[model samples]
Target: MKAKQIRLATRPNGMPTYETFKWTEETVADPAQGEVVLKSLYASVDPYMRGRMNDRKSYVEPYEVGEVIAGGVIAEVVMTNSTQFEVGDIVIGNLGWATHQIAHEDSLRKIDPSKGPLTNHLGILGMPGITAYFGLLDIGKPAAGETVVVSGAAGAVGTVVGQIAKIVGAKVVGIAGTEEKISYLKHELQFDEVVNYKSENFQEELKAACADGVDVYYDNVGGTVSDAVLRLINKYARIPVCGQIALYNLEKPDLGVRVQPNLLVNSALMKGFIVSDYGAHFEEAITDLAKWLKEGKLQSKETVLEGFEKLPEAFLGLFKGDNIGKYLVKIAEPSE
Candidate 1:
């Protein structure tokens, strides 16, 4: 079988561009024993993938300059030699930018589509959801009647953080870029308050929204936005640094207000975490999230683009804040 994959053409200085990627086709060998050929159904494009594009040492190794860029993918088995999987079974794994892939059965988890849309496996029920669950519950630790504020509150992870805070009886406030995103967070998600960080009076608005003072701050976007939120933390506040999307594309170092003084004076606890930190408890978190989703207590939204060719475009849109909830690309459908 033939598959086209996206590859890194060059290391990105900051925000990646069309010139940063190259597309190529490869011949996929037939599945060997214990292996399967997968047709990509849906795949996710996230902010973390941006970090991988940079030639830097981080939690994960950088994507090799000439190899295929890989991430979360939901696929269907087209051919299988393993008894554990059937020809038509849907599966999930850390796969490639290609439309099809060959993988060992152990590498993929069978998906039960009855739980939700298969795309959910790449979104609300996948990495972004897990990231929100642990980062907010374990780190932010919002309590009833306390104030919880999330920057990038309209994003995939940020939206879920706010909803979960409300579930735990916290007053949820969200800071986002556009009025539309702000409206979705406030009106659709029922967030207690929403602030437009791009507004001229952003600091004032956030101050007024958090009049009771922030008890838990979920920092998805660092840099200036985080700087503003840090200034308003109450004594013993909790800040979980999820991702600094604002700083990911920087071509140069961003020097700004030092945060040590703020953390020192407020006696706040600030920690950075990746979702895998709670891998042992993923089942517990996913079960709870699934329950809430089934009961309509939790809602998920997504910006889905069609076709394999749109993968790069979809990823580029993430930094521009083009999507609501989770962003995904639908590559193909199962023949079965």
Candidate 2:
């Protein structure tokens, strides 16, 4: 089979553009013993992938200049030389940008199509859902009747964080970019309040939304938005620094409002974490998330772009704030 892969052509100086990616076609090698020939069903586009584009050491190593861009993918076992999986098995893994690829059996985990739609593996049942699960519950530790504020509140992880706070009996206030996102966060997700950071009186609205002050702040976007949220946090507030999408494209470190004084005055506890930090408990988190999903206590939303060729467009849309929840590309469906 021939597969097309997107490679990093040039590291972005500011925001990534078409020039940053290069596509190449190649004949896929047959899977060796203990391996499987996989065809991608869907691929995930996430904000964290932006940091991997730059030449810097982070929680994960940066992608090589000419290497294939790889992240989470849901795929079908097209052909298998391994006893671990059959030809029709659905699996999920950290795979390449190619539509079809080869992977060792150990690198992929089978997904039961009976539990949910296959796209769930790329969203709620996958990394983003798992990230929200641990980041909010373990680190943020929201308690009942507490005021829980989430930044980037309508995106994948942020949306789940806000909904989970509601499940924990906390008053949920979500900060998003647009009125549409605010409506989805408030009306659809049932958040107690939703504030648009793009509004003229953003800080004032946020303050009014959290009259009791913030107890658990799930931060997905940092920089000035964080500065505002930090000012309203109550004493002993818990902050989980999940993502700093605001600073991802910047050429240099941001030197804006110093929040150390806010932390000091409020006696707040803030910690930065990569989702892999809780790898040992992923199954536990997924189990609970799946239960909540099945019970209708949670909803997984995604903006899916069709065709593998549109993957770049779908990815670039993340920085543009074009997606409401998880953003992904549906390359193809399994050939059943």
Candidate 3:
């Protein structure tokens, strides 16, 4: 079968443009023993992918120039030589940006559609949801009645973080870029306070909204936004550092306000972590997230762009704050 893949054409010094991606079409090889041929149904676009574009050492290896960009993908098995799966089995894996590709049985996890929507595997039930789960609960640990603030609060991770905080009985405060996001967080997600970071009086509004002081700060977008949140932290505040989308595209290093002093003075716990750090506890997190979702204690939102060709645009939309929640590209409908 002919398959299409998107490769990294060039690495960008700052924000990536259309020139960064190179599209190619090639024939897919037949599945070998213990392998399955996958037809992608959906793909995830996240802020963390920005760090992988650079040729630098990170928790995960960088995507080499001219190599296919890989991330969480939900697909349906079209052909299989593996005993573990049969044709029409839906699976999720860290696969390439291809319409179809071959993957080993061990590398793919079959999806139980009874749990939730297939797209949930790429969003709330998958990476972004699991990310918010461990980061906020394990690290931040927001207690009942305590104030929890989340930056980029309307995006994938941030939205889940805020909802989870509310589930635990915390007063959730969200900081997003647009009015639509602010309204959604405040009205739909029931966040106690939602501040627009782009507002001219952002710091003032944030201060007013977080009048009780922040007990837990889920830092997703670092930079001046974090600088302000740090100032309002209460004694013994907990901070879980997730993504730094604000500084990811900068050509030069951001010399923002040093965070050490606030952490020192407030006796705050600030730790940065990637989702893989808690790989051993993924099942635990997923179970709780799935339960909350089923109970209506947690809400999942997605911004989907139709077609495989929209992958790059959906990815770039993440940095532009064009999405209200998880951004996804729907490539095709499952043949089953």
Ranking by lDDT: 3, 2, 1
lDDT of 2 at 295: 98
Residue 271 lDDT in candidate 3: 94
TM-score of each: 0.98, 0.98, 0.99
Worst 10 residues of 1 by lDDT: 327-336
- Candidate 3 overall lDDT versus native: 0.93
lDDT per residue for candidate 2 within 1-336, as digits (tens), equals 999999999889999998899999999998899999999989999888898998888888999999999999999999999999998999999999998899999899999899998888778878899999999999999999999999999998998998899999999999999889988888999999999998899999999999999999999999999999998989999999999999988888899888889999999999999889999999998899999999999999999999999988999999999999999999998886
C-alpha lDDT (0 to 100) for residue 7 of candidate 1: 93
> Which number leads on lDDT?
3
For candidate 2, list the clashing residue pairs, or say none: none
lDDT of 2: 0.92
Please, what is the whole-model Cα lDDT of each candidate in the order they appear?
A: 0.91, 0.92, 0.93
lDDT by residue for model 1 (66-126), tens: 8788999999998889999998999999888998889898889999988888888777788
Question: On TM-score, who's better, 1 or 3?
Answer: 3
